[model samples]
Target: MVITVPATVPIESFQRLRIETYTDVAAAALLVYDYLLTFNVEKSLIWPSRWNIMKVLFLLTRYLPFVDVTLVLFYQLKTNISVETCRATYFPAGWFIVLGIMVAEIILTIRTWAIWGRSKRIGIILGVSALVAIIPTLYIEKVFLDSLVFSPYPSPATPGCLLTAGNPIIAASFVIVILFETLVLTLTLIKGVQHYRIASGRGFVSVLYRDGVVFYIYLFGISVVNLIVIVAAPRDLANLLAIFQRVMHSLLSARVLMNLREANQREYALAGMQSSPLQHLSFSQSRSSEEDRLSFRRNLDGTVIDIS
Candidate 1:
């Protein structure tokens, strides 16, 4: 009896797979490091805080990536994985990435809505826009996953799954993401400018705006790069940035929530130190209507603050 062994993958293909594996490993490692760095903040500011919708969303955005990243690392690092196993694992991994991004976007949407005084009109608009962007993007993602062409492992020793072709239509999902982010950023900037003009100090509102803008910039750049890689790169090299972008969505969105909570804690502490009724009166009088609407007030436990 004669047996055949598959030929080794070409050097170029092996190199690309190596690079992709490195990216997956980097993303997983970064998430762990970030979790450690922020664990103290989470304990102090988040764990003790009253549970609200924002808190729930923050927790979801903060920790859900562990599951997604684990799946990704498995898919990328498991040697001798079958093509059937790859097909079964890959879509779930993709869905996890999408779910992570969607949850983070929800957190940002709520933040934007809060900065805008939680106006019902603005909330309605954001909600509608999110639905519009999300539903189609999800459908496109399903189509993209369905269109993937996975090849047999180039060699028995080849690490991880191999994709020989993919639908560039996946690029459309990133385009939608970029467009939605633009809208969110525009709203944030307009409110930020208003806050800058009226607010006298770097208060909670300032922290919210600053973080929102910075987060937008980083996520926007990543989304663009992901789109470009999908559209222009070879199928083997496509999706190189997908996991990184999802990790950023989780990491940055978590930061935005934590920073806002921390700023609220500081302002609450500072306000408590002031004893003069006259000073309070003067400060209240000086605030514009918009500033008043954006004011932060702490809960009885002093662990949570909300823009009222």
Candidate 2:
């Protein structure tokens, strides 16, 4: 039974789709460029570090996009892809994006958790708020994906899938993202104010605060644009910024980890150089004791700086 549906997508939608393909490629290119630029820092600073939860998160946020964007580009650019194949790809691709965003948020949440002196109460609050935001957003995405109606390609030469229409309810997901980011930014600002009131000058804590605020703002702005497009633009333009948002989340979160690690290493090196000769001699004589001492100090500093 051949079920034929009329072509409903306009020429303008195809033009927008072409632009979207370019955007995805650009996002992927940026990911590769960033990786090359930071490869040395990652090797020197991250590789030697012991295996930990944060290391796992950093690697996921860093490398998962390679696989994601590859799949996305293939789905978008592959010629003669069947409608069924295109439909099948939507669920995994959408979930992959949601997964990336969630992991990045976890990194931010942990950072927020640390800045509050690792208070269990604060941790619980953040954890619960994340869940509240995430649950509804996921539900909305699932509903939107399930409701999507794909139009058949006008010709066999068509390179990608086309959407007949988009559900405006998808905008809800970005609204939730903006709200959650607002909560995270508010928490960071409150903590920053408290930290600066006591501390006279900038230090590692300042770095965490600065990055948190800046990244949150960036993510917030992107989410706003995404929401506006989904609500105000044509159905074809609804997802124009989705790939960019995911890439930014991965890029910025990876930077947060790398910058924190590098700063910690520099602080440790400076502290070591300033030690007295007698102290150095003592440390040299008891290498094992020094290792333990340094390890404890690293953990303490990591906690203060929200490395986890």
Candidate 3:
């Protein structure tokens, strides 16, 4: 059975869909702007560190959704576009979204790695798993792009690029993404619990538990809504929901990066301050009682014993 959207939808319904799409895109853009301006200081993020580099990369991902929306709006306004041209224009939008999601997922994986004591094995395993998960999304994207279909809107006034009559397999792509996101979030929570147990709720460890859980829940919630909209919502509203999802991905990914960095900094700063007063307590050890040498060592947790 070949499912097809009607070439001529009711005029009012189409207009409503258009309005909803506009509103959703506008809201997403505003959110990205708000997060960037509120939390990210340009000078602060310019530092040369692994976290800062990743923060810069993550910040760059925020524009993908906006750029995709701009292309969509441009195509909508054009009067002389062929079906092939329109299809070509919309093709990159899917890949752009996939790229944005992939970048965000990478940041999540990095956070998980950090929470796992930056173990090479754990990072490698998570990285490989994430890469494996991406294969299906890419495959589905190819299928969707190959089987792409387009039909004109109901109104003559808004005649340009045709609206997409979405494919079933295309919707299934989001399921793969959501599954991978769940996997990452689960690993994060597990690592967080283990760390809390081992460290006895040490300084700034709560950042992982609190921010990690909250951010994952929020992103997962958005992913669930995105999948639901793709699978069950009316076709007109599906794309709008997707737009919202990408925007939130960009916003929250950046916020997570910022939060984790701040948490790590605060932890180190506090540890340094606490250890400052003990720095002068140098102990001397003599091998044969003729000469003494001073040894300097610092332990911030106050658990180490000085046998000398």
Which candidate number has the best TM-score? Answer: 1
Tell me the lDDT of model 2 at 182: 92
Per-model C-alpha lDDT, please? 0.79, 0.77, 0.63
- Residue 200 in model 1: lDDT: 59
Best by lDDT: 1
Work out the TM-score per prediction.
0.88, 0.87, 0.76
Q: How many clashing pairs in candidate 3?
A: 0
What candidate 3 gets wrong by more than 4 Å, as runs, is 12-16, 39-42, 47-56, 76-85, 198-203, 268-308
Q: Number of clashes in every candidate structure?
A: 0, 0, 0
lDDT of 2 by residue, 11-93 (tens): 77679889999999999999999999999998988887767778888888998887778778887898788778877886688
lDDT of 3 by residue, 171-198 (tens): 7777877787788788888866665554
Residue pairs with colliding backbones in model 3 are: none
Off by over 4 Å in 2: 1-8, 276-308
- The stretch of ten residues in a row with the least summed lDDT in candidate 1 is 298-307
lDDT of candidate 3 vs native? 0.63
Sort by TM-score, top down from the best: 1, 2, 3
